[model samples]
Target: MADLGAGTGLFTRLLLSAGAARVDAIEPNPEMRAELEAALAAQVAAGAVRVHAGTSEATGRPDASADLVTAAQAAHWFAPEPTVRELRRVLRPGGRVLLVWNDWRGVDAPLNRAYGEVVAGFTEADVPPLATRVPEAELPGLLPGGFEKRLFDHAVPFTRERLRALAGSVSYLPSPGDPAYAAMTAALDRAFGEPAGGEAPLVYRTHAYLGRLDG
Candidate 1:
């Protein structure tokens, strides 16, 4: 499997656990690559994975060599045409391209609303979800030949730690030291309470777009 833009190897780790034979974690950001390396050290030592520093548009794998390719929450950063071509070049005939995204559902909920207000105060824009912006209408250009998409609805248990980590995962948020950062924290506190509603988690819609290359 190809794990594109594998930040800190989160999705890569999941793929490994799910028994993928091998995963080539492709990441372009240096700091993120370092984080990925640190996170996947044991996996690499166990011979479960390899890491490649590159972008989705230019994965260094041999042509038509991969059996399956997956980009988790990172394809949006790539320009569709080049990325699709690169993916096609590396995927074996009849291989599948799976695009995965974890979009938070019910963003209009009370807690979510407070979360958005904080982010908006800082960035002048709410932290727009990546999946919602995908060019589903122009998908033909993104997938050579044709493809199918599937929506996988799911939820992840969220706590203060997870929420904080989620906020940190985003690229635009002000750091904990920044002044606007306090506002975000305050917003989070107001929205989720000091400890967050017990174990009951927010649901997220995990959208999966599986596009196969023509044989």
Candidate 2:
């Protein structure tokens, strides 16, 4: 198995927990790869998980090295054709791929709408999801054999603090000490006043695309 854009090894950790014999965790950023290596030091030392410095389009693994390739919340940034070629190179015959993203498009929930407005102010454009902007991905593309999409209705509860963390986790969102960070957070505070439970639901759905990489 190869996990692209492994980041801090969030999904990589899940793969280990699910009994995958081995996983080649590929992440381009040195900082993130370091964090993953540190967090999974035992697995790395045991040779169960290997962290590599690479990207979706240029994984350092050998041809047919992976039985499965997965990208979670990270494929939007990938350049389609190169990434497709790389996936074909690294996957064994009939090996599978999974691409997942959280969908918030067209959502009109009060909290979601309010949050989108806040984000839009910082981005200086429409608040439509970046996932939706990717070509043939949110629906279908690279998978010439076609793919299966499974949607899971989900929601995350967020208070101001949790919301700040969530925003920070996203690569594009303003982070602490950024010029826009304080303003974005202040706007969020206004959009979501203190709730009874200190959190409110941000409704969204998870989209999982599963396909065999025969093509």
Task: Please give each candidate's TM-score.
Answer: 0.80, 0.85
RMSD, candidate 1, Å: 3.1
Q: Highest TM-score: give the candidate number.
A: 2
Off by over 4 Å in 2: 126-140, 168-180, 195-197
Expressed as tens digits, the lDDT of each residue in 1-215 for candidate 1 is 88888888989988888989889898888898888878778888877788888898899999977888888887778798788778888988888887777776444455556566665565635555443436676656666667777765555666766676676556678777667766676666666665554533556667777887563
**Which regions of candidate 1 fall more than 4 Å away from where they truly are?**
105-110, 117-122, 125-135, 161-165, 194-200, 213-215
lDDT of 2 at 149: 78
lDDT of 2 by residue, 113-159 (tens): 88877777776344445634354443345566678878787777878
Task: Determine which window of 10 residues in candidate 1 has minimal summed lDDT.
Answer: 124-133
TM-score of 2: 0.85
CA error at residue 11 for candidate 2, angstroms:
0.7
